[model samples]
Target: MSLLRRWFDPIRSRWFFQKPTRQEVLPTEQGLSIYLRLDDVYSYLAVQQLPQLEEILTDDLKPLKVVISDTAAEPPNGMTKTEWHTYCLNDAKILATQHRFSYDEEKPEQPTQEALKQAETILKNTPLTGQNFLYLLEDVFHMLWQQQYGKLRTLFVMASQHQKPQETPERVFDHTPVLASYFEFGGRKYHAVDDLLRLTRRLKQQKLLTDNPIFLINHIEWREHLMSDAEELAEIQAMHPELDLYIALEDPISWLLLAYIKEELADYYNIQMNLYPLSYRSRDHFDWSLATRLSKRAEVEFTPFCRPTADSILEMAHLFYSVPDDEQVDAMYEILKAVWTKGKDFSFKSHFQQMQQLLSIEQLTDVNVAELLARNDALCDQKHQPDFPVLELRINGKHYVFNSLYRVWMIESIFSNVLEQLYKSENDAENNEFEISKE
Candidate 1:
């Protein structure tokens, strides 16, 4: 990241998230509003929390405004639209099971287009506003997600045939996925799922809550169930799913994540990991402030650091590839700590020499740093809307990719999936053995 980009990105985001759409009804200064879509899995999860959110907001001044967005952003994670929706459905199911959200386990994993169409029609016609809209919207989400097409149609017909909506809810949707369904409060935007914890903190900061309330969202925590079953995870590790991580050496979030993988995950899970280093930040898709917040949740130390000069990044990139395969993890982790945690400026001759000697790097001759970064770029390009510190997992011809900066706890979630597969395979094998003995 350039020195200028370090400052400009946040400023640009602040302006972008708060800027009104062309047709947006201007919000009252203190109004709490959200934009939701009928098809978004997370939007369904957000609706489940409204009663709790309302309780938390009881002492506050305004009812939450609901925007029924009509469009969606491109699917993330290099997935086709169908693939992204499928992942969201499965992910939300896990979230529901873990957090006790209302979900119909027997319902289809992905809602059919017919189901979504009924929801859109009903939501478009429902006679409600403020908390009344909140009341009906939950039922709408419930019926749609639970595959209650018959009940949804009844609701839709009842809504369309006899209802008199005093005002129609406007359709204003942005292509940005985060904006597709999010809360706007105190001039800041919060993604309804990942940023739920952050939103609560902001509320407390503004004195909306005098202290921590009885209501808390625990989904952001590392799945405690996954952590409890170390023996199962150890068994699954033998399957050898590979975690390919791409990092931009100068980015602080990369350092923090590297520490978490080493400090928090290394002992508990055994999987082959390959690390690739880049001399530059993955600019466009990167989320900056959110990355810092994620670091806090991961419980890794992070400190603000000067953006490394171009020269320093080049030197470090070359040193990383020069290291033996067995030594790469330690070499990369040390580099991350010195620059990110200690604010060491490897651009300085003294600092550069010290880093080289500390990591036991030998003198370089004809080092091709550009080619190394190009290789990183090629791997990173394999992702859709790729960002620095990308984490990709490959197992049994299936890929699970997590944007580590957005959801640090997702790594745990990934392992949970792995364990589930391993257990099922083991059970099937045992059944086969028993059948053979009987034969």
Candidate 2:
């Protein structure tokens, strides 16, 4: 391990980072502080689950609603506005179907001020517990997102009577621009279904759950179910499909994902892989360090503390772009591994020489490294993306943008169908059915 890795490994491996003990009591407040925006699709889905979540926790569940700034919500760490919008809608559809929540793709009215006013009225008059507050929240969210204007008019009239007080409720709007629904409990923050599942597990461990059966309706399975049999692999490998991967050298998540692709999916299927080195300025809104830590938590093989400088990132990108088309993927893989796994400084001449040796090349003479960097930068600009490691798999002329490794299964599922169709058409033999194993 490098000095950086050695120093940070123990810190990152702290007890808090590990799975919580059954006896471990959370060290913060007793209730759940949900940060929400009425316009956010994720918020709507999360709110729908609150009734169930509250039923499980009972008195322990003190759900405080904090309305966030909707207009200020930006695309996730490395997504374009268009891409983000598409992803949100698609993800919402899948989640809504799974959770049996109603969702519409059409743009909903901005109900932040109205919802806040109503929430304030409820908090001032009614006790912030039981089904009343939950019902109010559900109604407000449904009215705004689902356009279920059933009792909203009566609720609005009742809310309007309560003078929109000079001092709003203690849990008034905190104007943070959040992209998704998240909960803060005992100093720890939980976002979306996955994080909420973790919180649920912790609560269960603490014996916080009443006799009610806890339903983690939104929990998503992370593992990708792929063919393990030799015959199945051979059959799939016959039909070659293309996987276009867009990566940013500076991103820790990209590094981890690249490593995962190389180790797991590289030879698993007969896919023509096209690697694109994406270049873009880092966003002021995102915390790269936090993302790095999160990536490490997701994949323990990831370097916990290593971060390459801007010049180093550019130099690495130049080397990546300068390589031959066939050698580019391997070259990029090695460069990422050096900085992210091996913790080698990209600025050093020795590291560059090592990378060159790994690439089995004397020097990159075919392309000007500086010019290649400029070209990649321009391509990144043209894409108009704000995030890193955006993977767009084009199958049958249709493009799907998958954000995380968890969604790799969805890609594989689609690939299975595509491969089966191609195989059947070629063979014209219904006798040999290509079974896409879910396990």
Tell me which residue pairs clash in candidate 2: 28-186, 77-387, 78-387, 78-388, 79-387
Span of ten consecutive residues with least summed lDDT in model 1: 19-28
> RMSD, each candidate, Å?
6.7, 7.0
Segments of candidate 2 deviating more than 4 angstroms: 1-26, 58-87, 97-100, 105-128, 158-177, 205-239, 280-300, 377-386, 404-410, 413-439
1-439: candidate 1 lDDT, tens digit per residue: 4546555544554464344322123233666667788877788888877656755663563566667665788765456876666657666676676567787766546567888877777766665666666767898888887777789888878876887444543323333444236888766678886577767766655656545654334454532434565566666566566777887776777787778777766655665678987656533333545555655667776554455666778877766776788888888888777766555666566767887888787865365778878878787766643345778877656787656566556666666766787679999999999999999
The residue-by-residue lDDT of candidate 2 on 1-439, one tens digit each, is 2556445644663433354323357754546667776667778777777776766674555444445444447675556777776667677775565556767756633455665555445444543445456666676777766665445656666656753533434345557878777887777777865467667766776777775444554333433444566776676667565777777666667777777666667677766677876553452233443454546544536543356666666668767866788877788888887776666666667777787777776666665665655666666555544455656666665666655544554556666656677777768644444443332
lDDT score of residue 438 within candidate 1:
100
Q: What lDDT does candidate 1 reach at residue 108?
A: 47
Give the number of the best model, judged by lDDT.
Answer: 1
TM-score of each: 0.74, 0.73
